[model samples]
Target: MATGRAKGRGRGRARGRDETQDERADRMWSELIQEVRVAQTGVQILFGFLLTVVFTARYPQLSQTDRTIYIVTVVLGASATGALIGPVSFHRLVSGRRIKPQAVTWASRLTLAGLLLLLATMTSALLLILRVATHGDYTPWVVVGVVAWYLLCWFVLPLWVRLRHTTID
Candidate 1:
């Protein structure tokens, strides 16, 4: 005997409370997937470019230390790519096990690890490029400056805003 608008309001009220853990996990998983999609594309592209660098003619001219750095950077890039892509594979393998909460938590960890690895890969790549392009003693300083800038932009600013605006419950 309920009207349509009353029934709609009832449904909305049902959804307004704090979500259960399972519901929260499902929502988190969807958000994580979307974030991973964005990161995976960029990491894959960067890794692909890193793989191609060794085959270029200019590679042989690099100093032994530079070669070593390049190798480490490529390995880091590969590792980052794998970590970033892991959540999709993980979700596919365990989609129906009713373990969405655990899956989401693990995927979040993997994504964080991937981001750290990506940061390292980018720093090393920048160092290599700067060294190759300008062979100057100032390269290390410049690299440090840029790394600090990246840290400030990526981590510090976000944390500062969160701390400034968010209230502790």
Candidate 2:
């Protein structure tokens, strides 16, 4: 079995896990969809809450800068929501065209972009809330710390794992 694996690797193997190209694409598509589902649910909930904030009685008391931040946060949330849901629409449109490999690539890109947008939205939301809650200069530092944590969990750690563990081939 080890020798057979070595021979397969030496021949520029097509797919890992013994899957054919189409099967690989299907598996990848499924995994990407699952990831999107988790992200989409969160963003959608956040966006829904954001949309309702403007009508809240407390919204009128926010400072001009806070209002600006709120607007930016809402926009970022909307963008993130769109990006996170884009993969589903992309897949649906391209389903019968037999171009899943390309679709998967596009979906993956969209998912990454969505996650970045989500990070921005969450950071902005946190900053606005902290500013309103604390009414102090320390809010920025606190927000920075939280954002760093998010970056570590969402990006840095994943990248480290990818680089540290993945085969160079």
Cα TM-score per model: 0.85, 0.91
Model 1 superposed RMSD (Cα): 5.0
Off by over 4 Å in 1: 1-17
The candidate maximizing lDDT is 2
Instruction: Summarize candidate 1's per-residue lDDT along 1-169 as a digit string, tens digits.
Output: 8754355355434323366999889889999999889888988998899899999999999999999999999999999999999999999999999999999999999998998888898899999999999999999999999999989987899999999976544
The digit string of per-residue lDDT tens for model 2 on 1-169 reads 5653355565564324766789889999999999999999999999999999899999999999999999999999999999999999999899999899999999999999999999999999999999999998999999999999999999999999999877754
The local lDDT score (0 to 100) that residue 95 gets in candidate 1 is 94
TM-score of structure candidate 2: 0.91
Positional deviation of residue 131's Cα in model 2 after best superposition, in angstroms: 0.8
